[model samples]
Target: MADFKELSRLLEEILEQGPAGCGCAVARNGEILFEEYHGVKDLESGEPITADSVYRQYSTTKVAVCTGAMMLLERGKFLLNDPIYEYFPEWKDTMVAQPEEDGSYRVRPAKRPILIRDCFSMAMGIGYGGTDYTHQAAEKVRAQLRANVGEYTLQQEIKAMAEVPVAFDPGTHWLYGFGHELVAGLIEVVSGKGVGQFLKEELFEPLDMKNTGYHYFGDIRERMVTTYLLKEDGSREASPYFQRDELFEPEAKYEGGGAGLFSTVRDYLALTQMLACGGEYQGRKIMGRKTIDLMRCNQLNEQQLKEFRNPYLEGYGYGCGVRTLMDPSAGVNSSVGEFGWTGMLGSYVSIDPAEKLSLVYMHNLFPNREAYIHPRIRNIVYGVL
Candidate 1:
């Protein structure tokens, strides 16, 4: 058995310092070594956070949608190198933006077609939300998507994203963008089912991850945690996003793959446990062990990994929507084969195949990169063992 007293003390240190609340768990060889929650779920009501408290997973939702797509890959439903245009024809004419010395960018034909692997690896030149001139194109596309959130289907939104000029040529440079959103749409197209339905049938049901979903509703609404923003004064303020009535509704207005989904620490542990167990949980095979190996493998080369941005991804290799540790020194006391990603709201998970260990730490703080929860928790987790 693993003693997590040090880990608990570390979580308490941060909880008292700033964050409104936190939830953490660790599992080894299908056994939970440590699981604990602290602080309040709602500041106003002073509701306590329990294992069942639901959280908006943000980008951490990528692993779930990617896992769904990887199942299709294991079934031989599609080849990774297959051009996405084969499914969404609108992207066949996709263009890339090339920067000039004058601080201007010119649109040109893509060097090559975007492939399914590009989407999974985030090498397709997809981008995230930004407000500067450099990100104007992606932001416009995102704004359009946000404006029509509930109106368009997943496929429709993907097509809209295609209309935006790509940041770079496919496979040239790596950018942590909305590839998972495209993957979510791809899953729907390949599986002949809605994204939510496919996940329910393929993953949530089998793993018994009942509380995980693209949307919140019913009695689960009451269990949803309040979102918070760390203020300049070192205090936290509740984000208005979670205070809305529709936020806790039964269905989502938009099923964004890049950053969507609300889940509990327990449910997410099941998902991680499946990956840690090489795509199986409790005798149920969610995906092939070989396929899981491919997901953990480094998918980028020297040049691509060099260009991979995002401070948290330092010393890691991009692979199928997850970050694989390419060098232990580049990460926080990690094994060379560990892989995982974090959410924008401070939720993070890591699976170390070398050690057969899985860790999940959850919280509700924005500007997650600045929060430093991921590295702190990771260091403590590794320090204990």
Candidate 2:
């Protein structure tokens, strides 16, 4: 049992410090045990955060995207050990990016090929596509996206990834980058459908997640909460929603698998609940129980785990695409096999399989203060449970 009153008070404190508004929900055994919204969706108009309010999921989108990919794996559509080159031949001879002392970078032929499993585990050395030579290559794709808009297709940009040298050899060290984007590309190729369309058909539709997708639908955009930037002084300024994040494009290819999803607390709960229930929603099996187990198993070695260090992820291991709890004291509510991911904008999704419990916490704040906020929410949720 949970003390809903205490939970509400704690969430109120969250709005006092971070995002202008937020929404959260928790479910156990397919029943929502706790659900609530706090603060205003927009500070100016005073629009309230509601169950239907949509949010840009950012990297949190990986959970659902990975689930869809794992579905294909469960069906034997692809094998984890298969090299990515098998699907994208351009990746056949990828190179490594080695930074020189002179502040420049050089390329070295990769020691091994990127396997499908590497993408799932973030061991493909893809740097979130922003800083390094390889990331710059990814940035070039986005630059083109900004310039030409719809002209730069997801496949075209993903294929162009081969031209960039990876930060490290695939399967060597874990680097959080565009590996999942590549996974999304793989999903597209394997399904013979666009990534967005494939998820709509395979996961969203089956779960009746009508409010979740990569773009605006019906009133989704209209119902979105305002994004806020939290200043060092602990004040929040309402910023434009979704524009800086490049979200809510109705006709977008949504190439980034690690980010670019729009969903609500209720809509995404459908996903976490299904995962918590071992891939079953209602009576239908979205995926095999064993596959879900495999997805939560720790996939990193001792050295790779070092590269995955962060405050919020202290006690977790990188599995499939979610953080698998290895040591509960590291920061989980209270389960060994708990797993899920976070969006860049302060949102978190946690699924604890032992108790068939899951939680979705949503807020849109820049410099999300994930280290301070996420653990508090996790503790409260688990403490009450």
lDDT by residue (tens digit), candidate 1, 331-362: 55888878988887888999887777889988
- Candidate 2 — which residues are off by over 4 angstroms? 100-104, 129-131, 140-150, 245-247, 331-333
Judged by lDDT against the true structure, how good is candidate 2? Answer: 0.85
Model 2 TM-score, all chains together? 0.94
Candidate models: Cα lDDT each = 0.81, 0.85
Candidates' TM-scores?
A: 0.92, 0.94
Best prediction by lDDT: 2
Worst 10 residues of 1 by lDDT: 242-251
Residue 29 lDDT in candidate 1: 74
Per-residue error for 24 in candidate 2, Å, reads 1.1
